[model samples]
Target: METLRHIVLFVHLIGFAVLFGAWAVQAFGGKREFTRLMSIGMSIAAVAGLVLAAPWGLPDGAEMNYAKIGTKLVILLVIGALLGIGTARQKRGEKIAPAVFWLVGILTATNAGIAAIW
Candidate 1:
């Protein structure tokens, strides 16, 4: 069980990497649209995080931090939704503002910040 938890944690980190890379490519490479990978990776990370909090991974007497977990979950949901919508809009031949992409990056970074510091 412990080993499985670690594996999930690793996958969670990989998801983060994919998201980060996606943003980097757009921000630096001058792309105006998000790839499907960005939304997919964000989802993978969010799900893995929840999996990490499964009861089997906790100490025998430890209680999960529901507040923090809930906050992160909500933030991730927003990120995923925003990216998904943005991608869809772009696919329809509509131009999405660069600021929207930047906002996604900001929200994602905020999620990372909260996760690391909280």
Candidate 2:
């Protein structure tokens, strides 16, 4: 179980990289698929991480830093929204602003760092 936790943590970090890299690519004029995959992958990875970091032995809420976790959740949600918007626009062949991608990417990546460190 201890090893599993560490593995999950590592995967969580990889997920963050994938999420950030995909978003950054889109922000820098990459394809919409990158943004789509990032959003979906990040969301799934987060859920898996939470499951792996389960309530084993620790009292409820004791191991959690809710403030940071909440911030991370919010940022992730915002990224999800951006992904949705990008999808809708892409369906119509519209070009989304790079600034939007940059904002979402930077914010989400920062949130991931905060969750890991803070």
Candidate 3:
């Protein structure tokens, strides 16, 4: 069970990397468009993160950090919303606001920081 948890954790990190990596590339490349890779990465991260939030593999009497988990979950949802809104706007022939595009990257990094620091 512990090994399984580790595996899931690895996948969760991979997902984070994918999402952030895609965002970084686009941001640095001067493109504001959303890609399928970003959505794929977010989906992977969200699913793996949800799995990690469970208590299945925890040691006896050890509890999960609900507050941290909740915070990260909310951030993930916000990122998802941003992605959806930005993609929709792109599809509608409207330019995605720079703030919206930048927020996605900022939030993604913030989520990773929280996971690491807290």
Model 1 Cα lDDT, one tens digit per residue, 1-118: 7688889989998888899788878788866588878877897898899887677766578887788888888888888878878888988988777778888888888888887898
Task: Mark the regions of model 3 whose C-alpha exceeds 4 Å error after superposition.
Answer: none
lDDT against the true structure, each candidate? 0.83, 0.70, 0.95
Q: For residues 1-118, could you state the per-residue lDDT of candidate 3 as single tens digits?
A: 9899999999999999999999999999857678889999999999999999988998788889999999999999999999999999988999889999999999999999999999
Clashing pairs in 3: none
TM-score of 3: 0.96
The TM-scores, one per candidate, come to 0.90, 0.77, 0.96
For residues 1-118, write the lDDT of model 2, one tens digit per residue. Answer: 5677677777877777788777767666666344556876787667866765465545445675666666777777787787778677767888766666567777777877777688
Measured with C-alpha atoms, the lDDT of residue 113 in candidate 2 is: 74
Residue 107 CA displacement from its true place in model 3, Å: 0.5
Clashing pairs in 2: none
lDDT score of residue 53 within candidate 2: 48
Deviation of model 2 at 42, angstroms: 1.6
Query: TM-score winner among the candidates?
Result: 3
